[model samples]
Target: MSDLKNDIPDFQTIMLPMLKLLQDGRQWTLNEVMRALTAHFNLTEEHLKIQVPSKQMGLFRNRVGWTRSYLKKAGLIQYPDRGVYQITEEGKQFLANNPPKLRMKQLEQFPKYKEWRQTFNSGNTKEKQATRTEEQTPEEVLASTVEELRNELATELLDKLKENSFQYFEKFVIQLLQRMGYGEFREDSTQHTGQAGDQGIDGIISQDRLGLENVYIQAKRFSNNSVGSPEIRNFIGSLALQGVNKGVFLTTSRFSSSAIQTALDSKQQKIVLIDGKELTELAIEFNLGVQIADTIDIKKIDLDYFEE
Candidate 1:
């Protein structure tokens, strides 16, 4: 069943009810509150099973967690211990004045909430006002939107990389390494060793401008298969053949458990592994092959400027 099929309440929608659940001023575990919330919302068993896009956790649970986090940030609740929380005295006082239903605008009355909103919306006022809605918290909306865009970009990047040739992949890895300050100089620091009879070494880089030390590299452009222990051992052997002690194994795929263990247990050399996800993250971070499409700056009030 599609996880999105269930009508999941947004974080804002759950905030007031969640706060009310702790009105008795007694400590409550996350599990207890979640159960109470499930009953309060009248959600069925099937509804409870509705998962998030990642399929790692339930959508309703995620929303409740966010709701709790926002309340904590606003100082309306306190964490007494791991997974346990309680309503603060300020929280009870809030309930005394406000109605059962609390809206985001109403929450702005609290200093902490107001400051949080100002900080979040600072210079991006137009963007924030356009996207702000009653159903979602500003932080949740922004985070989820960024995550969606990032996931899409990652998918596109992997697809484009997979379509390229192995030789192209090797050069791409070298370019990424160079961008990350691996090679001291672009002209002579990096050398491709993936030619015929080059053993298992795909590339090498001088760690410094003087070429005092070298770092061996192995780039594997595998789309789906895992780089296992045997491949890692072969790379280490290639490093030994070159008499190098530092190496990096770059793969457009995951490394097996045994492969990771082998790299860690190696006493003769220091081996660093870059799997597909990590590689894509680095590519995005360093702008290796990607360009920034837009940028936003958030600003805040300068109280000192107006102070007497």
Candidate 2:
């Protein structure tokens, strides 16, 4: 039983209005955009799940960002702050002159997308248009489009996880590794620490059979606090006793200069460290414990029919 559905046309239809809203001088957050989109289109969160296909707020932000990026690259919009976006003067002129085509050709005007569009439309021909259109189900089209944008968003989130929390932060890392096909890892939830509370390891995973191969994991769920080198040294020490050469240190907080140097200097085992941002990204990539919400379809125009 799956809860996924195809609804891409919904997004193509919404992009303009989204742009216009930004153009109209209304300042809106991602959630506000979500609510507006859902209301104006008579859509629900369920509808958006298919239209955008993610349950995370960050996903929605990422979609808006892609839209903004396309618009901006085309000289249509601009970002004034971390969460704020506004339309540009060129956006007004483009809207006034162009009748608004939701296909890639129109979106290609943006410099950032020129290469992508050129490649996408390279093989397109009138005779083959109909066949290609029919070949793609609405859901499939949306899935592909959203995935491209998701990759960009994942890259952005990767940089932000380093300043967040260890609990949720670590969860994202574990999920990412699992998604990458690394399994048999569990988080540290032990209640007793033999007088040194939770000192054994943040988490552990067996990369192979025979229990001979393993990677030690440490997730620092710091809100803004920085993790220093002494902690990293301790984790390395634990790994040495087990003769494991691979370890991962993840933190919602950034690591100190000394700490990072120490991990590299340890020379005993290789340690991979993931901060908060990277953790969230891995979670998205792995789809660990995450569910798909909805899908959208973007269709190209049949110009040949008009020429005929």
TM-score of each: 0.55, 0.43
lDDT of 1 by residue, 1-308 (tens): 56544466677778889999999999999999999999888887888888876677888987787678668647699777768889998899888877767656566677765543442332222234446655678776676677645644554475467668988888888888888988744678898888778799888889887777988889999866789999999999998988889999998777899999999999999999998777877888888778886555758899999999
For candidate 2, what is the TM-score?
Answer: 0.43
For each candidate in turn, give its C-alpha RMSD to the true structure in angstroms: 17.3, 12.6
By TM-score, how accurate is candidate 1? 0.55
For model 1 the local lDDT of residue 278 reads 78
Tens digits of per-residue lDDT for model 2 on 195-305?
Answer: 235564655666665555666677766644678888889888878876778988877556778988888887768987765545555677567544565554557899988
Where does candidate 2 stray beyond 4 Å?
1-175, 184-197, 299-308
lDDT values for all models: 0.78, 0.58
Of the candidates shown, which would achieve the greatest lDDT relative to the real structure? 1
Model 2 lDDT on a 0 to 1 scale: 0.58
